[model samples]
Target: MYRYDEFDRRFVNGRVEEFRDQVQRRLAGELTEDEFRPLRLMNGVYLQLHAYMLRVAIPYGTLSSAKLRGLAHIARRYDKGYGHFTTRQNIQFNWIRLEDVPDILDDLAKVELHAIQTSGNCIRNVSADHFASAARDELADPRVYAEILRQWSSLHPEFTYLPRKFKIAVSGSTHDRAAIQVHDIGLQIVENAAGERGFTVYVGGGLGRTPMVAKKVREFLPESELLSYCEAILRVYNQFGRRDNKYKARVKILLHEAGLDEVRRQVEEEYEDIKSRDALTLPHDEIDAIAAYFAPPAFETLPERSETLERAKVVDTALADFVARNLAPHRSPGYGIVTVSLKSVGSVPGDATAEQMEAIADLAERYSFDELRVSHEQNLVLPHVRLDDVPALFAELQKAGVATGNAGLITDSICCPGLDYCSLANARSIPLAQRISERFADLSRQHEIGDLKIKISGCINACGHHHVAHIGILGVDRKGEEFYQITLGGSGDETCSIGSIVGRGFSSDDIVDAIETVVNTYIAQRSSPEEPFLAFFRRVGEAPFKEALYGAAPAAA
Candidate 1:
């Protein structure tokens, strides 16, 4: 993790002080809610359904053991006993008092974390693969670059107040675990024909009312030129992105309107003009310095799978399922990337209790060299756990309710706080998710379903990533009542596409049955268990699921 330099320390402290004064002014009746709204948003505070929600940035999803402990402390002290990890790789406290935000941020700052840029219409937090440093096929660690972008974009005087919120992601591996295709700017670290590593840049991608996959702007930009190239892109967007209509204010809208060729031309012109600026380009030494911060720890070489782990897998079904699903391939020989699923049976999808957070921190220290990652799917990942310690680790995780064996199963859902926490939401997402999970709690049924992603978004902001789930569920308000809409064939991978609405929306009470209908339809239509729900849906259109879901033929329904 990158330590806060003096400049960082000073800037964060200054922002905290400024916000503290702003809160005082608002309380003193000098500023109305409308007047103070944007001010508070800039500090990552939101006035939600019942209380204020504070989003704290976990930069690039990296957290040290001590920092993880700090977050646990916040959960214990200010809000409820848990916190929700979000798709943007940030954490949200759903029940926070307005006055406690400053104190919360102060606590966060003590452990090199803060909520700066977690919200606001400026550039938001940059994300990357949760398994960046430990993944098997990574060409280079992406967090080093993400950290660089964090410093460069934080309170950037030129681009701080942009047309809309901007998000960027970097993927060091060929696999797109970070969902880079759905970001405003996506960078894939690639090695060129000349054998030098750099970035393949994609711009103007986003998921909202209008979802798009970013277009490639640069094939292989030199690593040193990342800052300058990124600045050029942002500068172009800020100068020409629409502001008249809020709906058309995002960079994606601009790209759509201007066409990719025109956008590329403008970006190139800007890049050419700024390429020679000394301060804009990151020097090789500076890149080296940044890289040093995320260098992999010393890994010991050992045999692949230890005897104890094999014996545990033979005995415990839970341990076996965890080893099979939660563990990912690691770059180092005897190690693996282990994900701690926060979506246990009846818990909030992305939430972690204070005790669970502490347990995860301890596990990271014991098995993963004190390094931890918060995945975009709301799971905690120990990116370099030795395979030999799998059994004992799984045992510890079971004790803490962190050993759920459903990573991409129906139970492993991405859900928003919905009406329970988000004021923008029209319906309750958590209860619906819980209902669906309980209905599909049969491990055999879920495994038979196979790698199905069910994402629930309370409203159309797509915060829960409903647009990309294999079975996307969106909660909507129809009059005073709540309804849920389903989308089919959506994905957040190399074959990225926004899901199409399957049929009419279902009532809140009717949603679980509707989901069951969809799943049962997949079970009937799938060729085999090897065929995923999305694959089956894509193969057979909405006809099967729609008929099954509506209990009538397509024309009749």
Candidate 2:
């Protein structure tokens, strides 16, 4: 993890002081809400339906134990006793007071964390795969580039007010774990034919009302020119992107209207002029220095397989299931990556209580390497745990109620804090998510159904990324009634695609049954459980599922 240098500490402290003054002005009636809206947003403070919310950045989702403790302290001392981890790899404290925000930020700065650029989004937090440095299939650590982008984009005057909020994601592996294809800018780190590392750049991908998979704009952009190329793309969007209507202000909308070829041409034209600037051209030493901070941890030589872990699994079936679901392959020999699932049985999807946070922080520091990662899936990761420690870690996690072996299962749903808290939401999402989770609470049933992703959104804002889930649900309000729309065949991996809606919407009372019907249809239509829900949907299209959900097979044409 990157520690704050003198410059970083100074910058954060200065911003804290500035926000403190702004908050005082607003409270004292010297500034009105209209005048303070942008300022508050710039500081990641939002006045939601129930209370003020503060979104703190977790740069690339990497955190030291100290930082995790600091967040837990904030959750306990400042607002409610829990915090919500978002799909964007950030955390939002939902019940913050407007007056205490500066103090909260000061506390965050004590641990080298801040909420700056987390909202109103100059470029937002640069996210990456949670398995960045530890994944067995990683091409490079995406955090190196993510951190670089974070530094370059932080408070950039030129991009401070773009056409709309911008987001960028970087992936260091062939798999799109970071959902890069749904970002304003997506960078896939790869090696060229000549063995030189570079990026396959994609632009204009997003998932609001106008969901889209980003189009590749460059086949191979040298690593040295990453910042320059990103700047070029942003310049094109800023110059030609829609601004008259906030609804169509995203880069995805601009690309949809103007066409990818034209957008590429504009970016290339811009790149030609700015590519050689000293500020944009990254030197080998600078790149290496940043990468050095994210180097893999030292490992002890040991047998690849742990006999003790194997014995523990053989004796305990639940332990075996958890080992299978929660553990991911690590690049280091005799090591594994553990996901601490936040989607426990019936609790909120992405929430972690103060005690839970403290427990996780202790686990990471003790078993993993004093470091942890917040996954975009709303899970925490111990990226370098020894295989021998797996059993002990699983036991500790189970005791904490944070260990539900439902990773990538139906119960492991991605949900937003819906109408319950968000002013922008049209309907309640958490209750529906809780309902579905409870319906699929059976361990055997969840394992029988096999790898399925359910994503729910309260509205079209798509904060929960409903567009790319295998089973996507959207909550809409019609005449003050909550109606749910279901989408199928969407995925956010190497083969990313936006899902298509099945048919008419269902009432809240009827939605769970509708989802169950789809699952049953999938089971019947699939070749086997091995064929997974997504593959089955793709193999047969949505007709069978639609027929099952709505009614019997349609009458002969």
Candidate 3:
């Protein structure tokens, strides 16, 4: 929701013009593929398996109706009729023409959006809880800080090309919906003993071939020191992070090699050096200005009208389910945050057609404050919808095929594009997700199971965030055959830990059945319906599910 200032506007326009020329030069044979690769990557263009893919940054997953419409325009005109919203709170078009990328960036810039920092080995888009400013229990709006970081990191001379890609996430609430623990830098908004707002910064967390929860580098950094402290962490990483091998290039690997104490010492030293520089430390006025950009729009003062809401609840069971599952607590009295589930049964988890995007844009403009947010789970959020209008909104969303009565339910899965669109994948993830979703098509059964996170990654990169899911499924190739491996007891919250791998892998034919067996085992062993699958699993361990998947045969063990 932060409007582009004059300087920001000029910078993006200039970059678009520069990329346009670069595209022309590449087409004219003035530059080789290798020579032009970095330039194109800087503009968020990638040469994928079948075509060029353009990734557009949705900073902190925040967007206005105008910006959403711009994305829909790109999807309709430049590439296919649909675009994929990624787990990083970005959107990707898989079938872009190389020559059209500059045009796309130009169009995005017009809407105060850009593709900068969406790709390459630089600080990527900063993500936060989609319901940031609107959340009832929010300590502070993380996007206000995320936007500041986005501007500071954009085309930053020193961090333009790090050893590998870096990601950052922030959460202002106790529940870590943004999965902060698995990012390269995780900032949790906290209060000090004096009751002033600050950040608890974590560093070196990532999921790839190696998955590790970030270590706490700073206990409580003042609001004014956020930028400088982050810069300190990046400076240390850029200076000492491994560049010897691609596999060893990430800051996480560097942290692993150097140990947390050394990394912490280096960052602290760097922070001390940069802390006094005015260029690094944001002024109080500037911080207030940034915070003002996210101030909630005026809402008509009204009491909670349970009479109207209860009438709809009495008549419509589906609406009641949606009201319970889709609505989130809001800071405003009569308003609530709503997540419009794109994971309708038998549909791709994150793919939104141009029409759906337009519809969502319209809904945001009409019912909310023209504000939309792309969630880390690949869904959209209208963060300021009124509770009294829930019935009408539900009807519109249901007509658009974006309504599904599962938010934290078992079937509401998080998945990667996987082997279908990603060249890096070893096996297919979408089909696997589809199979699992179909297996739990019975809404009552899914509700009975309750609050299970099924995250699937195509390969070891963990793009699907498999390591953070309560039920993590990883797809790997064994002797040219696709097999799926299961990991249990993982979480991405205040209590973060990498999942431990279960005994063995399951064949593609057996994965759905294996997941069913795991669920059924939880159902049979659970003490009560209130016990979630994760709680039950944590209490009983993986022994029951392991036995169910691989029978009593000694080889199964």
Pick by lDDT: which candidate is best?
Answer: 2
Question: What C-alpha lDDT values do all the predictions have?
Answer: 0.89, 0.92, 0.88
lDDT of 2 by residue, 79-99 (tens): 789999999999999999999
Clashing pairs counted in every model:
0, 0, 0
503-525 in candidate 1: lDDT tens per residue? Answer: 78989888898888888888877
Whole-model alpha-carbon lDDT for candidate 1: 0.89
User: What is the Å distance of residue 25 in model 1 from its true position?
Assistant: 2.1
- Candidate 1 is scored at a TM of 0.97
- TM-score of model 2 vs. true structure: 0.98
Between the candidate structures 2 and 3, which one is better when assessed by TM-score?
2
RMSD of each: 1.6, 1.6, 1.5
Residue ranges of candidate 1 with Cα displaced over 4 Å: 551-557
Minimal lDDT window, size 10, model 2: 548-557
| Global fold similarity of model 3 (TM-score) | 0.97
Q: What TM-score would every model get versus the actual structure?
A: 0.97, 0.98, 0.97
Clashing residue pairs, candidate 2?
none
Evaluation by lDDT, superior candidate among 2 and 3: 2
